[model samples]
Target chain A: MRCIIRLTLLEMLKKKILYLTLALTAIFLIFYGIAMNYGYDSLRDAEPLMRIAVSGQFLSMGIYALGFIVSFLSIFASVGSISSEIEQGNYDAILSKPISRYEVVVGRYIGILLVLIPYATFFYLSIIGLNLYFGDGVVANIVTVNILKSLSVLYLLPTLLTSVGLLLSTYLSTMGAGVTLVILYFCGMVGGILEQIGHFITGEAKVVLTSIGITTSLVIPSDIVYRKASSILYTTSSGMNFSADNMLGASIQPSGLMLFYIGFYIIIMVVLSIRKFQIRDL
Target chain B: MMLETYNLTKQFNGKGGFKDVSLSVREGEVFSFLGKNGAGKSTFIRTLLGILYPTSGMGLMLGKPIGDVETRKKIGYLPELFQYHTWLTGYELLYNHGLLYKMKKNEIKARIDEVLKIVGLEGHEHKKIKQYSKGMKQRIGLGSAILSDPLLLFLDEPTSALDPLGRKQVRDIIFKLKNEGKTIFLNTHLLSEVELVSDRVAILDKGEMKKIGTMKELLHSPLMLSVGNCSEKIINELKKIDPLLERVGNDIKMSVERDNDLPKIADSVVKNDGLLYMMKRKENVLEELFINTVGEEDVR
Candidate 1:
């Protein structure tokens, strides 16, 4: 397993995928940096609420953009963890060694996470830096401890999505896993939005959206956790009287229980992928 | 025994796997599986390596049940057309392989140089595998396989992508390994390789073992006699000396227990009004035995 991790990291570096990802992230940050500056400049003459509101909008967009980039990286990185190696007939030589199959799967997961975690942290911190600069030092009003909480919760979203991609990889082909993950991503996003706003819609529309949300949540709850993380970032005791569950300033926050559930989800994905990969013939 | 299997069967939904194979390979011999593509050679090796579960029966390698990690420590396998991590340099790949075998860092580093030398890859260690040609990739693959200096080696078509000289060089290495008291299980349809190095060979066809024996035992030395027969008298006379003598057109083929019988058969044919055009010993090559054993099907 150590060998696998070491070799995988070496491969990523040699292929320049790590550097490429970071470079792509830098470009994204540059664009975000420019947009944040312009958005803040426009809000200079606006009312304080409207300024905070636009700044908040920029902050949310920054978070979502970072989230999307991380999600894309995680999915593409993990979707081929086992299936591609098996397809190319490379696993036979490696798996024939004294190492257990579980080690390979878990080690691969660690290798990918090792690359992604630093990527996530760098990008997440960059966005926070932007938030501090463009939001007129608005986030400074929030406690540093609360900022840490929000950062951690925000980072966990990518980790959860990565686990989902890995879980799908153990059974599906690379393309199949990627497609399924996209579907699941949209499901979580739509389900989070519709279910949170189901109260305004009357008649059967409410019933249909609620059913979709319930089913998607039961199956894959990563998007809901992401929304919960957004709420954690902006919502406070002195915040607006927002009834919107999907909003960052919403009153309905995800409980601590869901954090543990995401933890459980990671463990279950790792275990299931290992179990399926153990008996898989290459 | 270095490896043994008793009625081992590994069928994928009752197709495309070996069946009821019972064979024992002693230590320090170059044992080979001679078969064409889709002939179950790779399947059998995969099963023995614990890559695939046997549908029935059992196997043991180095006195432990198949797939035993401890037992695998003494075994090295070079799979067919092995596709390595192309982004890795040859040195890094060998180093990683040594780590997989749980070798100490210093020991792995020390052995990597020697392995690279043995595989004739001394100067190319820093080159990425993507830059390697087919033969270079194959040699690097072999280098990793033997990095731990295993007691038993399994090579599937080890020389498939190699040139003629590369094939000979690798073959010499196999011989050297055998001289070092290492047991090797080689799988290939290359009859010449089997003829030169294999102490024992197993012929597999359509997921079944057709024959298994030592090189000499498999290749029956037959005397070929081409003649123009004047009567059935020569045929009856030849049958008296060997009941299994076969008549192929104007030629007769019969296994000779001794060279003295050849003279007697020629005298009988000449005295019995038979015109003996030629009298010579056949090549008794592995190709003949392979053809005879598997028959001429899609052994390709």
Candidate 2:
């Protein structure tokens, strides 16, 4: 199992995409830093409350982009982890060894997480670092100790993606798994928007839209995790749910029950992946 | 017995896989499975190795039931379509396989050197598999299969893609491993290979076992004689030995059940004034057996 984990990590490190992603990440951080510096300077004369609102909104956008990149990376990296190996006949030699099928699925999951966790940490801190380094007095004030709590929630985004991605990988072809996961991810994102819109409106439309959002979250809780993270960050700092005014913000904080459900969702996905792989013919 | 299967069956939707096949391979013996494409030869191997679950029946490898994790520790397999992670170097691939077999790191390190030399890839160990040729990739795969010095090795079409030289190299390796008292279950459609290396051979046609026996029991080498001055007396005398003796242009072809009949055949031909120009047993008797067992139309 350790060998499998090592091999998976080595394969990811050796991939050209990892380097491309890092290069692109460096470019993104640079642009983000420059934007924060210039945007802070432009708001120098703004009133105090206006500065806090604008900086919080700007920081929310940066975190949203960060989560978006990590979510896609997690999905694409793992969607083919099992299915492609099967398609290419790579598992024949490996699986015939003394290791159990459960180890293969779990080892790969750990291997992917081993790479993704540190990466998410670095990217998360970099965005916060840029926000702090280029952040004027207003930006610093809004990023409170609650940022730590929010970062933990942000980590769930990739965890949720990888678990579901691996589950789909066990059942579907690489293309089929990838397409389905991406479509589900899009559904989650659009559902979040509908929920946010539903929060602002009233009557039957509100109930219907919010129900759709909650339903998609039940299918895949990725977007809800992101919203929950955002809510933790902005609401704790500003003493207000800024998403009500800011479009990118979390309008309704995902409940504690949703967090428990996400944990349950991940376990089921991992368990199902192992069970499916064990019973299926490679 | 190193490997045994009793009525082991694996089919996809009740089709295209072996059915009710039972065989046992003894220690230090080379067992060959002969079949055409999609004959369930590979499927049977995979089932025994626990890569594919058997739909019915049972199998044992090294006395443990198939799919038993500990049983796999003593087994090695080179898949018919061998594809390793191309990103790994040859040494890395072997080391990882050894790790999967639960070999100590130091032991795996020591074995990698010997395995590389055995597979004729010593200098190429550090080269990535993607950089290696098809033959080199094959050698690396063979190297991985033999890395743990397994008690039983399963080689499926082990030499299908090699050049003549590469094939001979693999055959030599098989000989070396056999000499060390290792059990080898070889799956191949190559009749010549089966004839050379197998102690016992089984022919599978259309997912059914058509023939199974020792090499001598399966192949009947016929005698082809070039006779000079053949006359009715000589022909009539030879008919006693081979009633179906065929004569075409001074050449006679007939099946001899035993080598003891050779001398009597020579004396009968000579005494009857039929000069014996040449007398030798026919070649490729396995090909004839295979074709007869499985119809020639399905030959691959």
Candidate 3:
């Protein structure tokens, strides 16, 4: 298993896509920093500004950007993990060794996650740096929580994508899996929006629609987790100052329950992937 | 049996797996699996390697049940269409597989060099597989298969894409491995290659094991005799002596029930025929056996 993981990591590191992703994320961060610096210079008022508010907003934006980046990168990285091997007949060569099929799936997931870590860390740190630069050190208190939120998005979102990617790789051809996962990511984002709209309508139909949206989000939780992480970063920086009367509501605060849901969602997806892989012909 | 299958059956999308096929390979012997394209050669190999699950029935490898991971450690496999991660050079690929087999780093290095030399790929170790020719890739594939010094090796068309010399090189390596007391389960359509290297061969057609035995066992036991340029009158006269005598293109083809009857048929053919161009017992010898067992349409 260790050997498998090592081989997988080495193979993934050599992929041109991984370096391209890292370069893109770094470029985004540099531009983001320049934009934030300009925005801070424009706002001259400096009377004990809510550092938490500024930091939270910055971190939220970072989470949102990183979330999408990670999701897209993971989809492209993982779409071919299994399917290409099968198509090119290398799956037989790999599986013919003394390795289990489950190890192959899990090892690939871990390898992909390892490749994504540097980009996630770069984005997370850039958000922290941006907060310190713009908020004039007021963002220091909740750096831990902000980092935690970024880490959660980094860790959990990819886990979710990995599972979905594995499941898709099992059933779809490489290109088909890539396109389907991208579509599913968008659908997940739309589902999150519909849930918010359902809250506004306030009826039995609204309740049903919200329930459906929640269930659909649970099925592919990339968007939901991103939103949750964004909310956490936002509230943490703002010190939870906003009243409950806001249009989005204090109910939008990141819930521990959602984190648990994402955890369980990943477990179930991985289980389904394993089961599907076990029965499917290679 | 070092390896055995009990009525192993597999169906893909409701079609194309062999049914009720039973065969075995004994230890330290070369067993050839003969089949044309889509004759389930790869399907059977994958099942044995545990890459594909058997839809029905069972197989045992190295005296244990097939698909057992522990059992697989003792086995080496060379897939038909070998494709390694293109990023890896030949040496890296071999070293990686050696590591998987738990060889020490230095030992892996040594073995990589050794196997590369044995496969006639000595100086090409640093070259990436993407840059390799098909025949070079095949040598690397064979190199990996033998890297672990496994007790059993499963080679699927080990020389299918090779030049004549390359094919001979592969065949020599196979014979050498067999001489080293390793069990080789080969899947190939090259009858002459199989004849030269295999101690036994099995013919599979439409997912069934139509025949299985040593070349001599198959040939002599089936009691086939091919005679050329024999007249129809002599052929009929031979048929009168032995009911199995039949005309095969102005030649007499007969199935002898016993070995002792071969001489009698030959004597009868010569005595009655105007002349005998050639007369020899055809014991389903590799090519004839393959064509006979797999059928003419399937052989091509």
Q: Chain B TM-score per candidate, please.
A: 0.83, 0.91, 0.81
Whole-model lDDT values for every prediction: 0.83, 0.89, 0.77
Q: Which candidate wins on DockQ?
A: 2
A1-282 in candidate 2: lDDT tens per residue?
Answer: 898899889898777666788889999999999999998887778897787778877788888998899999999988998999999999889988999999999999999988888888899889887877777575635446667888898889989999999999999999999999999999999888898899899999999999999999999999998888888877645575554254577868899899999999999999999999999998
Q: Which model, 1 or 3, shows the larger DockQ? A: 1
Positional deviation of residue B156's Cα in model 2 after best superposition, in angstroms: 1.0
Tell me how each candidate scores on DockQ against the true complex: 0.57, 0.76, 0.52
Clashing pairs in 2: none
Cα RMSD of predicted structure 3: 5.2
> TM-score for the first chain of model 2?
0.96
- Give me the candidate number with maximum TM-score: 2
Candidate 2: residue B180 lDDT (0-100): 98
Give the per-residue Cα lDDT of candidate 3 at B242. Answer: 68
lDDT of 1 by residue, A119-146 (tens): 8879878987887777675332444555
Work out the TM-score per prediction: 0.89, 0.94, 0.84
How much of the real interface does each model capture, measured as fnat?
A: 0.67, 0.83, 0.69
Q: Which ten residues in a row have the lowest lDDT in candidate 3 chain B?
A: B220-229
Residue range with the least summed lDDT across 10 consecutive positions in model 2 chain A: A236-245
Order of candidate numbers by TM-score, starting with the best:
2, 1, 3
